[model samples]
Target: MTQPDNTDDALIRLFNVSKRFGAKLALSNITMDIHKGEWLYVTGPSGAGKSTLLKLFYLGEKTTSGQVLVFGTNMNRLARREIPFLRRRFGIIFQDFKLIAHRNVFENVALVLEARGEPRAMIAKRTRNILRHAGMEMRMNAMPTTLSGGEQQRVAVARAIAGQPEVILADEPTGSLDPKSAEIIIGLLSAYHKRGATVLVATHDTELLARREGRIIRLEEGRLVSSEPAVGEAP
Candidate 1:
């Protein structure tokens, strides 16, 4: 299949990518080129390895056998020390929200910038701005546990974007939100895509796909069954 003509016409490329847990074979020869500045949905039934695929892109997991390239470097051949450097291009969100209970929202977002050795002034400015964009500035000093589920998830989203990564991976971000909250989060992500970032949303939300601007690929039992263009196709 032809890949999208996006910002980095030669961005993330996966060729015959597969992963296995012993003989379980979690993914099998999944190949695709994810261009820059495109929004794609990695849709699949349970146990289809969608999560595993996302993990590989973020360096959280490695492929068992395949050539995985990000930017221009081959991941499997890279050194352990290189992994952290490679992941700077990505922002990730999970269903669990992964917030530290003891940390307030500002601290949660600040943690990312701090890890990268960003200056205090930069961290404060960026964290505050990102929280405002995420609509959580007022809750900046509130603990994650003190906020509602939706609010906590927004903080996670804010932390991810505070760095302005080249790629954003959202693993079931809207799974437990009310319709209004889901739209708010989803719309924010859509806006990011519009501003030119590679986005892969691992989800089963057909409703969102119905309004997609990129493409959808479905995985079944670790095998890619089909690929389709988004609804409008911009024709």
Candidate 2:
């Protein structure tokens, strides 16, 4: 494993974290640090615990033991009211896209701003800008079911980035798209990473894994099997 920098700058940290769902151990003792402004890939095969780890980061799932700290606060100890505040700092892209089936693209993305209590005018402005960035401007008023898989994923990306959060957590973002659409999704995430947002992606796609560059961590049966800097990024 690559030794995490022993500084006070990590954006996310896990210390001997473990999670269990009934009799099955979903994740074993895992210790890792995701630094600010870094791009990280969590890669593993099916049932290898990739999704579980990402869930832990966003507090969608809690650890059975040890601790998780985000933006310097121990999430395990955070009050329920505080979880939303912490989540606002993260943009999560789900494998299923997770869009509101009843809402139009514009309204879907606008919901992010709405949750934060932004005024109507600013929500309209930001939502339009981000949808444009994702190449979904023309589909602003279209419903999710009317769009193609790639288009829907683009909408999801737009929503994730609409808030310009400090961190982006994506799970199998391209798992369902064709090659070209997959490229577009990953490219968008890379653009954000280049602009200094911390990013963590979990996937098992080898081709997708080969095309990107970042910190690569592999998991096997819930164990941290490998951690290394991207090919050109090694110190």
Candidate 3:
């Protein structure tokens, strides 16, 4: 499918992007644009390269060929010292909820702001507010191991948004949650997107696609198969 045409509004652009792990090709010739304030769903079956595509955005995995441009900067040419600064512009949520094991829920979220050198008072206030929104305030002092999968993921979501990042990249965020928890997670993401943050969700959950309206891009065997609006959605 032809991709979006408004280059002026594009926050991320991929041109002939491809990734290979030894003999295994993870992504191939991915050329597209992710516009600012857009909510995009990346859907595919297992081993279809959904996660790898998201990784390229945050620099988790380097592409073997082609370029990934974020905020007008080419990721392939980014300097080592510049990576952390570039990553601060993004909020990434992993399926496993990569919270610090020793840090409590509040600390886990607070650390993001702290790393950015935010003032102590502001960090405390924002952390509390974000956790409250995620329904994790009550468990502020609880460690990752103490919280259920749903609770941990909630904390992960809270941490991701604490910095008010311009973009959010979530990989299988609701894959292991219960139906209600999944709904809650999606709701939180949708709320963030409504606030003008770009959101890219990698998921294979049909129920999730049904619950939300957005542009959907499907991948198969490392290649983009389709890019279109959801059924009943206005293009």
Candidate 4:
């Protein structure tokens, strides 16, 4: 696949990319551009390589072939010491809601600021503000184990947005939530997108894919089969 011709404003680009796990090819010859401030959804059935695609963006897994550029820097060329810096520009939400088991809600969100060496006062203020906005403020002192799936996902979102990252990469963020919970999670991501952050969500949810605003890219057997505006959307 060839990349989009006009990528001057792209935030991430993948050129002739492929990924393999042992003998299985997870993604094959994927060339695409994720533009700045564009909301995108990577949709496919299970094992369609949606997760692998998102991982490549964050360098959680390197490509077996070709190049990936984020913010115009080649991911393959990024030094080991510089990986953290590259990641700081992204806020990732995992399907499992990877919060530290022992950390309270406040501590979990504050951890991002702490890693960036934010002052205690600043971390507290930022963490509290995001949590309050996420409707998790009342659970600030609660442990992950005590929260329901919905609450845990909310906390995970709070943590992701605490640093005001430039891009958000969410892998099945609402996979385990009820319909109402899913709405809340998507709404939060949408709010961030409206604020100028680029957002990409990998989901298999039919309802989510039906949303009319985002650009939807569908994958099948590791190949990009379609790229189109959401239903009822123009272009």
lDDT (tens digit, per residue) of candidate 2 on 19-95: 99999988999988989998889998888899999999879999999888889889789899998988899999988
**TM, every model:** 0.94, 0.97, 0.96, 0.97
**Best lDDT among the predictions, by candidate number:** 3
lDDT of every model, 2 decimals: 0.85, 0.90, 0.92, 0.91
lDDT digits (tens) for residues 91-111 of candidate 4: 999889999999999999999
Candidate 3's residue-wise lDDT over 81-135, tens digit each? 9999999999999999999999899999999999999999999999999999999
Scored by Cα lDDT, where does model 2 land? 0.90
Error of 4 at 114 (Å): 0.4
Error at 100, model 3, angstroms? 0.8
Model 4 quality (TM-score): 0.97
For candidate 3, the lDDT comes to 0.92
Which pairs of residues collide in model 2?
none
Report how far residue 195 has shifted in candidate 1, in Å.
1.4
The list of candidate 2 runs beyond 4 A from truth reads 1-4
Count of clashing pairs, candidate 4:
0
Q: In model 1, where do residues sit more than 4 Å from their true spots?
A: 1-8
Alpha carbon lDDT at 30, candidate 2: 92
